[model samples]
Target chain A: MMPIAITDPDDPRIEPYRAVRERDLVGRQHRFIVEGEVVLRVLLQQSRFDIESLLLAENRIDSLSNALENLPPNVPVYTANRQVMDAIVGFPIHRGILAMARRAPLPPVEDFLATLPQEALIVGLVGLANHDNVGGIFRNAAAFGAQGILLDQESCDPLYRKAVRVSVGGALIVPFTRVASANAMVRALQGASFEILAFSPAGQEILSQVKPARRTALLLGAEGPGLPPDLLAQTRTVSIPMSGGFDSLNVATTSGIALHHLKSQRS
Target chain B: MMPIAITDPDDPRIEPYRAVRERDLVGRQHRFIVEGEVVLRVLLQQSRFDIESLLLAENRIDSLSNALENLPPNVPVYTANRQVMDAIVGFPIHRGILAMARRAPLPPVEDFLATLPQEALIVGLVGLANHDNVGGIFRNAAAFGAQGILLDQESCDPLYRKAVRVSVGGALIVPFTRVASANAMVRALQGASFEILAFSPAGQEILSQVKPARRTALLLGAEGPGLPPDLLAQTRTVSIPMSGGFDSLNVATTSGIALHHLKSQRS
Candidate 1:
């Protein structure tokens, strides 16, 4: 696959790479930008997305020949020098690699839940608007072999460039879709026979005391206003048991700890 | 507890708060800058540091009256408008709070270890250069009640501004000190009668199978090039069983999981 030379930063062919920081990806529902060679490799392997095109630093093209050979020939791979690359992204792009990818419409919450195995362990995030937390949770889900992740409407898009990078490409691999609210997520999981467990600092039971059922769905909320009291009442409440009365673990870290207990400890 | 008014951004008394990002904090070994009202409140309570002074945005002063009353009379609090605050910090300073705190010299690693109780669970970090990871680990350490954290010299300063913010002021609460290298960190912990456990992907034993001793230390490395081969050989290698053979969890997340097991499982 020969690389197309992009001499001008404003080349219409590579318009997708322009001034990325200012553009809110939320409005661009079908498309997301992923940066760095590591994440780009993961994007190429996933089937849920199509690689629209790839923009690379001129010097990186020769080294990426092996990776390029595996990519579909129809995907346009554009090469730009440092100056043009910097101009397109509106900053010094570190890995000198970027890929514009298109996501297929996600299946509805009920439809997606039906695809999971009977013993599947899933993570449901509620009102987590921060991209870093969303990405980190996916990374944790991937590490522990979680079957899928469910996100509420208020959660940020996992594929946001910064979130994808922070997840270290986990966002590209872990299967995920969104639901309407935390309550809706709980109902769908229950309908699928998954035991809903809501985690919060104020919960009654310590984490180690909670026995994960055959199919468990761990629910977590944002850092400050933790899992809703009403929502928690409807599910088994488990807490990490702060030793020194420390506030709480970062949401991503919380996901990793809970997922490890359910997935690895059970195994 | 009246606030000292600073009409000019160039006031020499507020010199400590200027251009924080550009300033070489590494050279200023004894002093650290903490930002945001949440972190500033934590700094005020910790005895490990002396409050040099505080610089606040004028609009925030009246609201922080209750907190202001708790400070010692000698501590000078400066107030400036939004324009002056932005000029000093080289960006939009949120929550209009900043503190220059002076840390007393850290005790020798060995000396610090002798101060802990008979049973202590500590997290040892090696070659973790990212500030967010360092901060996140401290937050995890605090959440799980780890006795202390020992960082290799290759790691970034936990007191770094970004790290302190990400830790949500955990860096101020958790006790930590530094050593020369990963090897030294392991040796010091071992000399203090700690069961050294180095966490890595290539380890033979599964995490749940490993037994914790009366005194234990969990050693973690950077994401890509994990604990060196020699370091792993020196300690008992315990691994997290990844069912999907996925890449390892983030170092901070791993710390939270491992520390939680060591701290809570025994209880």
Candidate 2:
């Protein structure tokens, strides 16, 4: 289980991982950093993504030996001491493991829609830019059997490092693609014969009253100002009935509740 | 709506709001910090609590005139320049609003229960060390009309600064009490004639199939290691049916699903 040893902090081999906080924000070459052992394992197992390389702190290599077995010899594994690891990453490296991963773009929205079965459950996001919220929604969508997720261009990147980790790597496994706008996203789902349900505090129809359709999409918006008036007017509005005068639930929490209600595979 | 001007950062009048990030962590006395203008307005309007004072950044003062009209003349309002505010708060003070408020200790758990109606809904938490989870649960509880929230000894304080802000003031409004341990919390709920349903991934019954009871409590645990096996044994178990082979949703997200399903009010 020998790994390539890098004694110098400035080694060119580990350049992708330098100053992770800022460098990741820059996000070059269609590749992203993956943190922690859980997300790394997902990247290794998911065929759609390729691992560029792996960097592990010297102390963590022995513990992660079993996990490294499946790595093809072609995938370089670089090991660095604590000092070099910290110097390379601009911060204290607590997780002690990192991987550079690149994902091929998912199928076009139309092709993705064509692949889903008739009795599909999908989640659509509009104007959501928070990484944690995007990640949390993807995680919930996976837990409740969502066939796919659709996002507007304004939606934050699901492959962003923080979003991927927060999702527990659900983003890596779950299928999702972003459209031009929420209006177009809704239109595409409707065109595919999916019943689009826009959720809002003012929604007239109660959740329990509406029956799940063969093809369904739960549309959610960012917190504060919810779905646009034009969008809400065009779709069937379903509200999760709440105590009078209380603020709406957090968007991710709202998605979880909505997904649980319309789950087609509830056994 | 004139406010008292604070020319110096070291003024004792705004002492409660000084060195806020660290001072808030220390949490001297019974008071807690509330940030953001929206939360500040909630503090002003909530009759259940008392305001010790207010500290507003100079630029934000004019915008908040209408909100300050109801404040009694005796309540001190301190206004400071942005630089002074930033220095005093140990951060940039972006939200530009802060409040000092205090609450008398809540009625003991038994007396609080005695006030509840026969059909009250409650949420019980065990070993939740994350403040965000605790606060997010309270927000969901409030939205769903839960009458009370119960926490075990290990759960973090809901009034902690980050928790309070994350909750969007739901923690200020929702009634909660802490018990000795998970066992004692369960016993108290059961003794009060509330049906205690512990949520677990391995539970036999699906979420929607379980009928909401007149008086019910949904029990949740920390994210990684869930409710203790002994606790799960004593109570009926309910599971949010998931797509097989995916990770469990975030603890906060899970609570939202369970709470929505068990929501007693449908109107």
Candidate 3:
């Protein structure tokens, strides 16, 4: 790895490493940022992504030097003082490491679906805005062996820095694709002969009672206001049986539980 | 409700709500500081806890005045400017509403056990430090009809601000008690004639294959490093069957799925 010294926060070369507030993350040119050692390590290990550059505080260089040695010799490693790093990052405390990696190209939805096995469990996120929950769902989807995660356009970026950190790097491993609209995605999946199962708190059939189909697509909405009626009408609704007095589970937790149940039944 | 005008952040009258960061919330003295209108409304509905005081920003007073009208006439409401509120609260962004309430007393272990039916599924937290996961577990526990929650002393405080918020006030309603230690808690449950089961990724029996018992206590630990070996040895180990490539589910999500499985079998 080539080490470059950066004495100023305003250094033009460190633009990619600048503080990522809400707006900066949404722009078309710059998608998202990745922070901390674990997530960076995962990104490096994955052959899919092209890491732009690495930034580390001068004090942290010695400690992380061994890990940095694994990077390709051509990759640039930028070093800055703790104060300069803190100023540029906006957050006073990060895990002493940051990496800018280009978002990997998502496979075409049609091509992605074609690669799955006869029986596949796919988690579809619709209008969910929480990054942590999105990351958690991805982590759970991977853990339960879901085919892939499908995200709607309005949903928060799954590659957001916080999402990557919260998922404990699972976001890097899981296969995901962004769909233009929930309706369009549902139509596409159905056209591919997939059974679209919408998870709802007020559904007619208990989740356990639903038999596993050949290709299952589980639809999960945001926490507070669940799947829109029009969206629910597009798919079969299934409810997880809960004891009396409890209303619902966290969206991410609910998705994880449902994925686990669906995987066990199918297997 | 009695309205008190406070121009100072260090007033002795509002000391209970001051320096909440430095104070230890474990003992009986301090209660969790709940912010935001939605959560406060939920707490007000619960008759078990005593409302210490209510603080509202000056601008928000008009909108909240009508809602405050329903509060007891003797309840004190503090009104302050944004700057004063920020100075007292330590955080610049105040959510317009804050409430300090007395923590409800927990029932003795024996008394709590007496209330549970013979066939019960209960969740116990052992050294789980994350407040969000703790709150999520409580929400999941309640949703799946777990009789109660047992928390080891080392576990994060359930009444902390983030935990309460993340739980959507479910922590206030869920029945929970802190045990001195995981070992003692396991022994206590055994003495009560309950089957103690610890969730492990490497467990021999899948959750579906394990025969449901009349009374079962599900033990869960923190994420990453799951249930400790000694804890796992003392109890029956069960695994949530996953597909070939996946590793493990989030601790809270796992609990929800396992609780649902256990409850479904009983029903």
Residues B149-173 of candidate 2 have per-residue lDDT tens digits of 8888898888888887887777877
Model 2: DockQ against the native? 0.76
Question: All models, DockQ values?
Answer: 0.77, 0.76, 0.62
Q: Candidate 1, residues A1-267: lDDT per residue as tens digits?
A: 878999988899998789888765434567889888777777776435789999999888878787777799899999989999999889998789999989767789899989988888888999999988998998888778788889899988888888888877788787899998888898899898999889988887888777788889999999899888889888888888876656678889889889888775577
Off by over 4 Å in 1: B24-26, B243-245
- For model 1, the interface Cα RMSD in angstroms equals 1.2
On a 0 to 100 scale, what is the lDDT of residue B4 in model 3? 87
Which regions of candidate 3 fall more than 4 Å away from where they truly are?
A1-15, A20-32, A56-94, A245-247, B1-15, B19-30, B52-94, B241-247
What ranking emerges by lDDT with the best candidate at the front?
A: 1, 2, 3
Q: Comparing 1 and 3 by lDDT, which wins?
A: 1
Fnat, 2 decimals, each candidate: 0.85, 0.87, 0.81
Deviation (Å) of B3 in candidate 2? 1.8
Q: Taking the tens digit of each residue's C-alpha lDDT, what string does model 1 give over B1-267? A: 778888888899998788888774544577888888778767766435778899999889877787777688999999889999999888898778998988767788999899988988888888999998999998888777788889888998888888888888888888889998888887788899999889998887777667789899889999899898999988899888774645678888888888887776578
User: CAPRI verdict on model 2?
Assistant: medium
